[model samples]
Target: MADRILTEEEKAAQERRGAAGGAQRGGPPHMRLGQPTEKSQNFGPSARRLLGLMAPDKVLVWAAMAFALVSVALTALGPKILGRATDLIFSGLFSKQIPANVTQEQAVEGMRAQGETKLADMLAAMEHIRPGQGVDFTAVRNVLLLALALYAVSSLLSWTQARIIVRVVNTAVYRLRRDVQAKLGRLPLSYFDSQPRGELLSRVTNDIDNIAQSLQQTLSQLLTSALTVIAMLAMMFYVSPLLAIIALVTIPISIGITAFIGKRSQVKFVQQWKSTGEVNSIVEESFTGHELVKVFGRRDEVGARFQAVNEELRDATFGAQFISGLIMPMMMFVGNLNYVIIAVVGGLRVASGSMSIGDVQAFIQYSRQFTQPLTQVASMANLMQSGVASAERVFEVLDAPEQTPDPAHPETLVDPHGRVSFEDVSFSYTPDRPLIEHLNLCVEPGQTVAIVGPTGAGKTTLVNLIMRFYEVDGGRITLDGKDITDLTRDNLRSQIGMVLQDTWLFGGTIRDNIAYGRPDASEEDILEAARATYVDRFVHSLPEGYDTVLDSEAGNISAGEKQLLTIARAFISDPALLILDEATSSVDTRTELLVQQAMANLRQDRTSFVIAHRLSTIRDADLILVMEDGRIVEQGSHAELLERGGAFARLYAAQFAGALTEDAEAGQGAVPRGVPVH
Candidate 1:
């Protein structure tokens, strides 16, 4: 099972359940789910790498930033412009109250004589005022219109900046996803053998998505927020330096709170994602192996495990959100406090004649704008942290070591005869445990070779080596006298076809499934292969015939029918070499006979290797090799091995002993050669 090619469902389960981890880290076996395997240990490097991915789109980034700057600048000037209209209203009202014949100087003198010193001072400070004039409605309307225009243009630029940022973020994320996918292909199979599948899936799917969302939401807002803060500060100082200094007092306090909370929440965010991956793994495994859990009556155990992991996720998420959630309210507190102080001080300054009422009002607005961005920055801290955490996982995939590359100039097979040779082959899954050592074998152009062995006897490993799924640790494997390593992996594998015990059919029509073996094959060829494998016999009975859509599990088809479809798929490839690994294990006696007939036709001119536990299927093979542990113990013709009564004979006898007894009691002298092993 471990040596077989993993189906999508199996890969999801086995990848994270790698046997390399001797002891689990997070909790009991079920709760562990390979937790913390994907957690980020370093934040800075990962963040820098993530930023580096955007280097290709720096032009767009700079453009967005520039637009944000101009937008913030224009927006900051709006309040000041409106302040002029405020001055106009005040001055117009006072001017209308005065007599038409009186001059501005006369009005001030009259107010002072009346003991209205503050009012006299305020009136004296007013500009462009005439004693006989009424309110200037036209001038006030012009100022209001100018202020509105500035706001409208500023909003337009802000929207443009957001659109530019959206493009930049999505492009960067798309490239990141592509690179991660390519990285997965380059990594060695052993890497998957050791890592959890669910964790990698999370990194590929969930983590990348989080990073995309974080960048999309934060990039534009943070850029604008920072610019707004700078622009507002300048406006505040321009209106009144004293009020600006008071607003600056809240900066240190806000920074202190953000830094303190951000640090704590960062750790919790890592745990939160880690637990999320674990939960995903448990659910994936439970659903993939749902039938097994029920057959074993372990549904309660699986449910309990899911609940425990879910609780862990809940706790981690709560801690992260609660701690980071403090930023907004705390920042709001400091902002409101700054607002109150600015209002009070600006009022005093206005009364002292150091500032006009209009200036005080504008300065108060500037103060609010200044602190609003600080509050926004504080609130965005959590999103940034979570995104960086997800980035770390993605970077880990990009940073993983890749498999050995193919030769710059590869060899090719000329008129290939399917001759294969193993020259002193040495291989193992681990360094400390050697499975196959100094092995050598050769097969002719067209010979059917059968291998029989007990479990863990390295039966599947031999075929895996031929496919170069794992490179030989030492020595060389050759095809037609050429070292297999000299050829590209694809070039070497193109000549071979294999059908395993566990049949894999994707979600597609029966014809589509068969065509998967040779994508370029025509419809006639697909139909011919199906007919040859007995798939046509039952497929025609279906409502859609060969066009029937198979679900993910292909549950509409029986196990034997699925097995026939896989054989048909293999048959369509029409390769020079074929491998059948316990291919008949899933079929009943009648179906097995049909499968055997199809295989016989498929194996006619190809050099075939058959790995089987039921010795009866391989009795007519040209050569039979009996194996024990990792070594071939004997090789001979089937009848010769039975006559020798050695390892092969013992295995054969054990499988058919009951059948032999029944035949003897039924008045038959001997068991027939083709009796089913089971």
Candidate 2:
């Protein structure tokens, strides 16, 4: 089958989709970052996993459920007891409180006419009561006292449920976080390299917090709502099945209305957020590039676009909110329609002597209870989805494939001479899209070897292989005749040291940052490392000396000084092999000279690999390797390569020729001082 060419728009959309997937791995924060994850849960699976989290502590979960059931049941019972009190008060008024000659309504009207405080109180007591043969204050008082007790018991049980569930939620979240942290250590470096830190951070912090809060707050409400619905329906049926069916009619109608409105509102919400984000981007660009806009004479165009975006955003926001807001009132209207039907029909039943007024009152309260929970659940559906999404994100980390396993019987390097070799190793960031292939190299013990190339020539990739940051797809790498993969990563890495271009320093004292690799390092050991790396000079220059704290950015210190601190950190580790990738790339010539001298001293008795863009630093290496496309194009000392007039010779001429020419013109220096720092 012939593959059809994609349209430009289709191709662009595919690229955007790819970018979005990449963003989830690691990306810059969007204003409403949570919005995507909130709606992104595999709802069915995540909800099952969430419930499963509670299953381990079955005792607490069951206890909480039991208490929740009791609380809601008592709450349901309260309305029925209240209806009985109304009946009792009416009976008492008709029999004992009202004048024999007066109608019940007339007595109430007379009391209002007199406006006597005591008489008004007597009238109010029998306002809904009807005349009866006798009244029983004893039974009424007993019923009221029982209600008070049930209410108290309900409150206590509800509080107990809250207390227990909160503990369970806390414990679950704690374990979840612990599992994530442990999983991070086991994850392959490729996972982190491909993904963004923001995604992981959100999972670790925001997502977990959402799950915890939702479980604590939503779960209790969800349980109570469920029980309330059940109890209300049961009470309604017992009072009268005909009215219960009428109340039941409202359920599907309310749900249907909610689902319809909810679906439309969700669409509007997505559009609104998209429009809002566009507006934000426009506003941000307007301010950030104000000077450019003015220079280009496009202020009016910018203003016109901003107005259009703002108008669209306003329309969407209003539309979404209006539709979502309709749920409550539409539900209320349906409820009221049900209420009017129940009251009218029950009154007729009472007149027919088939039902009592108290039962009608009780049934009305039961109907409210039934509808209230449905309304609450409808409102909470979004929150539940948001919570489930968070759980899935957290679980994603826990479920990621870990690093490749070490050999069952691993080899060990007893006295590592740091003789490193790569034999026909192959690997790629993407499958079949080879970044490095069939590459081979070797370094002798105590040899200072330099690998230099243009950007993307696989110099750093080679170093990464030597350090085993990623496992090679084929062939092997070895240290002192032992296969690197046959040894555990910790053991392999313990023998190697690396200084990368990017300097990472956390928030801590300068001393702490320097001693990060060896926390138990003695002051003497730290000072020795610092003095060797020329970090002592800067540390002492600060008023706080070594105690000076570095911020997360480490902006208080110069970039060169921060780089030196990292060199000191590596020095403190005292590994058998060293890999320096642009170690002095950030420093000035003078500072670079100082670092070179320190590095020269450090590499005296250890095998070292240096990856440099600058040719001047590594001319004196025992061997020089020129790399292109993951293969060595030339291998020799400086003189040999210059004589051969190959890739390395051309590279050398392009970079250091001016320095050598300048030195020659001054008649004070020659050969670009290529050999040693001092």
The most accurate candidate by TM-score is 1
In model 2, residue pairs whose N, Cα or C atoms come closer than 3 Å (at least 3 residues apart or on different chains), thus clashing, are 25-195, 25-196, 26-196, 90-129
Clashes of 2: 4
Model 1 accuracy (lDDT, Cα): 0.83
> Relative to the true structure, how large is the alpha-carbon lDDT of every model?
0.83, 0.75
Model 2 Cα RMSD, Å?
8.8
Candidate 1's residue-wise lDDT over 203-228, tens digit each?
78998999999998888898999999
lDDT of 2 by residue, 255-326 (tens): 799778776665555455445545655665577669998999989988987898789879977886777777
List runs of model 1 lying over 4 Å from the truth: 1-44, 97-121, 132-134, 657-678
For each candidate in turn, the TM-score is 0.90, 0.80
